[model samples]
Target: MTVRVLVVDDSLTMRNLISAALRQDPEIEVVGSAADPIEARAAIKTLNPDVLTLDVEMPNMNGLEFLEKIMRLRPMPVVMVSTLTAAGTDVTLAALEIGAVDAVPKPATATPEAFHDLIGKVKTAARSRVRARSDAPPREAAPQNYSPDPRHVLAIGSSTGGVEALLTVLGGFPANCPATVVTQHMPANFTASFAARLDRVCAPTVTEAVEGAPLEPGHIYIAPGGVAHLETTPGLTPRCHLSVGDPVNGHRPSVDVMFDSVARLKRPMTGVILTGMGKDGARGLLTMREAGARTLGQDEATSVVYGMPKAAFELGAVERQLPLHRLSSAILELCADPAVRSVA
Candidate 1:
């Protein structure tokens, strides 16, 4: 199927560059172009493109503000074009909260290759269904837990396009959310960067898990990129287990490893398998479910690749499937009850 796209940016050079990159792929067609949000609004109405490539910083109601309006008025898939800078990162996160599908970091040089990558991301985002949550109450800046009882911990796993997905899910958390751990398949250098990115965007304190550190509510620990798996230890407090032992499901920081640990250490934990391209988390999520954990999977329509969640669903690991927009609220609803506590 041909994926139609609308490129929105103030820079004519950027607009041309993006258009050219997308045209190279036969599957992607540049339907229209807009200089700013105002023009983009009209273009979106006229062109009715399948996906939108939005710039983070633009004149006349910045990209983020415009994106909010678009989500409110006409929700669709949007991929953000973000600079690889601190401030740009912040704005990109805002875009995700406003219902952007994903973010591609723009290279400093802005070479042909950079725009080509952006085109690829746009195409991928276009294939995914990203709807806006118009009725859900606006999330607060603090980490909010759906359950107040502290009985259930949340163990999530993802890969490939996980950076943006993780941030979006965590950003919806309130200040007093449940203890959470994540395993996003990535290389050594990228995990730290990803964790730092989440720390900056998410309300909960996020950091790369260190050996022996206790898991705390409102704190999120990301596994390091090395050949180690994070497992929950005993004592009502969990410790990080970093090992070069072996790759589970062809992954060092395997989702199965984390999920299994949660099932063993915190039965009745909540298992969330987000967008990914592999089956690493499927088995582990099943174990969690069997252990009485509530399991949630990102629906196929909202997934970037749909491989992981599909596998988990086939394995009967998922008790519920939801889109990206509703995931946070669903998680909150599962955890917000003060009487809810983990059976583990």
Candidate 2:
């Protein structure tokens, strides 16, 4: 089925450019365009498009406010179009938490490749499931009997629908949970803001990974995007290392790079591959499993896109596949198990 799209942006040039790019995909149709939220509301009611491309900054009202209203009143798949500035990145991350399906940075100058990428995001967003603004799944309370091992490190990787997925999983962690590392596919400017948001909402402290930062319990480190791959160095003090290198699997700070580095460490580890569009982390997860680390993958039923987890499962890298809501509990259980810890 052809995906019907509504373009909402204050700039006529942007609307035209977005529309032109999406139209290049034979499966996508530009049904309408709107200059502001007022116009967008009307277009949404009449056109009832399959997907929406919303600009983060608009004339009458900002995109964030409008997005909240839409998600509350009528939940639907929405992709945010934002600039690459710091302020824009912050707002875009907020939009994702408010139930937007995904986001794309507005190109400074729309090139053929940029248009192709935009078109691909729109197509993926059209197929994604958008939950209602208030429809969060009930979280299980932290297990009273569980105590995490100080020597255990939890490493996670995700893409596409990861912002909310990571939020759901990490929000369930206890204040004194195990030390963790994450390599989510995000832009350079967005990682800091993303980490800040996670810090506020999660029980464990979260920060963007820094070079030589000591991996400590109860703190979570996120790999900085676009700059370097997050890796680990083995020694008396196992610390986070950022390495500048060519993009692996078409991504800098690739999940494979992080997982492979974690595999080299002497301490016990747990690897998780969550919802994403590609198979970037499959091989690395396999390496972790081969090194006696417990590995988990998010199951298809709960995944927005199952590509990464599916790849890991098929490769025999993931020992268990669980739904989104159950993953946090499973991680805690694995961490507390003496049998699992002995493999380290």
Candidate 3:
């Protein structure tokens, strides 16, 4: 089936360029184009397009605000078009949190390769599930016994829908939670901003991981995108080490790399595979399970994209699979279990 798309941008040139790129794909059909949110709102009602490509900066209303409205009133798949600037990155992240399916950076010049990439992202968005903003209910506080352990480490990996998933998981953590690391597939320019956003919303301190940074309890470290893999060094002090290497599983800061490195450590570790688009972390998560580390994977019903967790589950790597709402409690239970902790 062809995917019907509506392009919304303040610039006429950008709308034309995006329409042209999308038209090149046989599976995509450009249904309409709008210059701003007001026009886009009408077009949405009339056209009822399957996917929307929205510009971050638009007149009449900004993309983030419009996106929030859309998610609240009539949720639909939206892919944000962003510029490669600091401000644009910030807005794009906000768009994702507001239930946009994905984001594509607007190139300075629309090259063939860039246009092709945008087309791919739009197609992916077309198939994504668009939930109402109210679908995410307030999370009940985790039980008192769910507190973190100073000696334990938690490693999480995700891709496509990771930002929201990570926020949901880390939001439940206490100020003195265990040392945690994350590998999420994203552009290099976006990781720091994403971490900063996570820090503001979460109780734990969230920051992008740096070379030789000491892993402290109650702090979360995120792997910088477009850089080397983040790995743990073998030493008395838990330090993060960035290694320059070829991209594994088509990602530089690959989830497999982080999980493998953590498996080598002597401390108690918990491995979690969240919603993502590929099988990058499956093998490494299997290794972690074989090494007696407690492993968890997001269940299909709650995942935005079930690829990574499904892969891990099929491989017998994930010891337990649960919905997103229950994962925080499960993690705490594993952390508190003496049998699980004794495996270190």
Candidate 4:
């Protein structure tokens, strides 16, 4: 399928660069360009492109406001192009909260190599089929004692395309769901906002983990930034622990680190590995399976990249593979089952 893209930016130079970059790929076609969000809105109505490449900082309303409007009115796949500055990172993360498909930092040097990478991001965005917010009912608060299963902890690991994936799964969880811990590969300063965003969209109270916070049912803890691992306390009482050690497999807050910790301390845990690139979680997931955990991997058909989950599945770490559309419900059913209950 050919990908039709709409380029949105305030700068004509950027617009041209983005359009040129997409045109390089035979599979992608730049259908339109907009100088600002207002113009982008008009273009969206007319072109109905498959994807949009949006600039974070723009004249007038700014990118975040536009993104919010887009999400509320006409949700679609949008790729954010942000600079490498602190302010840019802030805005980029905000874009993710507004439901952007992905984000790419604008290169410092405007070279051909940089343009190539930008094009790659655009192509990836075009391939995504984002579920519009208007299509589904707003997430509602779940009931108390909604968790059916009382077994081991709920472990979730995600990266790259994780922001959207995590929201979808957590939103389906009950207000009083099982104790859930997540490690999403992200830079420092981003995790707090990410957790806050999840809390808004999910019934469960979500927050970035702090040292020795008791792990309780119905609450979700996100691993703190700059850490490679988050572990649970052994025996009866479980709690959260964060560490800022060397990068494992080239990533801090690595999936492997979290999974290994869960495997060692939270046996029989429900392991969920979502969309990402690279092999961070595969080994740790395998260890989790060996420790008698019920492991689930997102199927390739529904993943943005399918690198992590595919690696884990090939290593026999995954007991079941599910498409993204079905993963949320599957997780709820699995964790909520009475058969999997664990006595403290």
Candidate 5:
């Protein structure tokens, strides 16, 4: 099936470049173009495009504000066109949290490599599952006075629909949670902003992993999305190791790389595979399971894209599968001290 797309950008050149690039693919059709949300809103009703390519900054209203309205009233798959700058990444991350399917950096010259990313994002957005804000109930809070086993580390992997899913799961973490590491596929320019966003929302002190950063409780390290793949140095006191290497599983900060590194660690672990678009985390989760780590995967019904978790589940990596709401409780339970009990 062909994916009909509407291009929304204030810049005429950007609109044409995006439309032309998308037109290169046989599976995607450029249905229309709109300069702003007002125009785009009208185009949506008339063109009824399957996918919408939205720009970050527009004339009248901010793209993020418009995106929030779209998700609340008329949830649809949207691909954000963002500039590669500090402010741009911040707004783009906000758009993702507001439920855009994906984001791509705007190009200076419309290079083939750049448009390749855009074309891929358009197709992926076309197939994404977007639910209205009203349809998504609030995620329950983490168990109160949760006590974690300091000897255990929590490793999580996600992509595609990960921003919202991670927020749902990590929002439930207690103040003093397990030493946690995550590898979420994202644009290189966007990771720092995303890490900052996570830090503000989640209870733990979240930061992008740097070389030699020690793995410890009450802290979450997110693999920096770039040339370096994050690894753990082997020892009683493990530290974050940023290994510059070829892309594994077609990603620099590949989930498999992080999981494999943790699998070699002496600490007990619980590996979780959440909503994503591919099989990057499957084999790694399997390795963790083989090493006696409890493995969990987000269930299909709760996943915006079921690819990663489904792959992990089929590979015998996942010991349990639960909906998004229940996943946090399960993780806390698996990582909890057996003797610690909290009253309801």
Candidate 6:
């Protein structure tokens, strides 16, 4: 089926560029174009496009405000067009949390590669499952007075729908949670903003993973988005290790590489595969399970895109599959449990 798209941008040039890119995919059709949210509303009512390519900046009501209204009132798949500037990056991240399927960085030059990324994102968004803001599923309550075991490190991997999913999973963390490392598939420019956003909302101290950073309890480290894979070196004091390598499974900060490294460490840990679009983490999570680490996955019902988790579950890598809300408490519980306390 053709993925019908409505291009919404204040700039006529951007609307044309995005339209041109999307049109390259024969399966995608530019159903309509809108210069602002007011016009976009009318188009949505009339054309009823399958997906929306939204601008980060708009006239009258800002893009975020309109997006919020759309998610709350008429939830649909949206791919945001964003600038790579700091403010734009933060705003795009916010858009993801508000339920935009993905974002494409505004390019200085309309190169084939830049448009290629946008086209891919648009098609992916077309197939994604979007929920109204109010239709969020029941979430397990965050645990109270949680005790942490430093022996157990928590490793998580996600993509596609990770921004909102991570916020929910990490929101359940207590002040003294385990030393947690996360690999969320994202653009290189967006990871820093995501880390900062996590730090603001979560109880633990969350930061972007850096070379030689300590893996201590109550601290969470997120893998940077570009060339380095985040892993921990087991030693007198476990320290974060970032290795520059070719992209694994089309991702640099690949979940597979991190999980494999953690597996090689031969330590007790928990591996979680959350909502994502690919199988990057499945094999690595299996390696972790074989190495005596506990493994978990987000169930299909709750996943925005169940690709990675489904693959891992099929491989027998996931010991249990839980919904997004139940994951944080379950992860913490496994870490604190005596059964998973011993080293491999």
Could you give the C-alpha RMSD of every candidate to the true structure, in order shown? 5.5, 2.9, 2.7, 5.0, 1.3, 2.6
Q: How far is candidate 3 from the true structure (C-alpha RMSD, Å)?
A: 2.7
Give the alpha-carbon lDDT of every model: 0.78, 0.88, 0.85, 0.78, 0.89, 0.89
**Candidate 6: deviation at residue 255, Å?**
0.7
**How many pairs of residues collide in model 3?**
0
| C-alpha-based local distance difference test score of model 4 | 0.78
Compose the digit string of candidate 6's lDDT tens values, residues 1-344. Answer: 89999999999888888888888889999999999999999999999999999998888998999999999989999999899999999999999999998888898897545678888787778778899988886655556666667677899999989999999998888777888999999988899999999999888999999999988899999999886999889886678999998999989999999999888776679999998887999999999999999999999988888899999999999999998888977888888847443211
Q: Which pairs of residues have clashing backbones in candidate 6?
A: none
Please identify model 6 stretches exceeding 4 Å from their true place: 111-113, 138-141, 337-344
- lDDT (10s digit) by residue, model 2, range 1-344: 89999999999988888898888889999999999999999999999999999998898899999999999998888989999888988899989878887888888776545666778777888777677767767766655445678788899999888998899899888877788999998877789989999999888899999999988878999999899999988876689999999999989889999999999997889999998877999999999999999999999987878889999999999999999999998887777647443211
The TM-scores of all predictions, comma-separated, are: 0.70, 0.91, 0.93, 0.72, 0.97, 0.96
Rank candidates, lDDT, best first.
Answer: 6, 5, 2, 3, 4, 1
Instruction: Point out where model 5 deviates above 4 Å.
Output: 341-344
- For TM-score, the strongest prediction is 5
The per-prediction tally of clashing pairs is 19, 0, 0, 2, 0, 0
* Candidate 5: Cα lDDT at 335: 88
Residue 187 miss distance in model 2 (angstroms): 1.4
Pairs of residues clashing in candidate 5: none
TM-score of decoy 3: 0.93
Residue 235 in model 4: lDDT: 63
Provide the lDDT at 237 for model 3. Answer: 63
Candidate 2 displacement at residue 180 in angstroms: 0.8
Can you write out model 1's per-residue Cα lDDT over 36-133, one digit (the tens) per residue? 89899999899999999999788888998898888788888888887767677667756765677677766567556667656656766766655565
Residues forming the 10-long window of minimal summed lDDT in candidate 5: 335-344
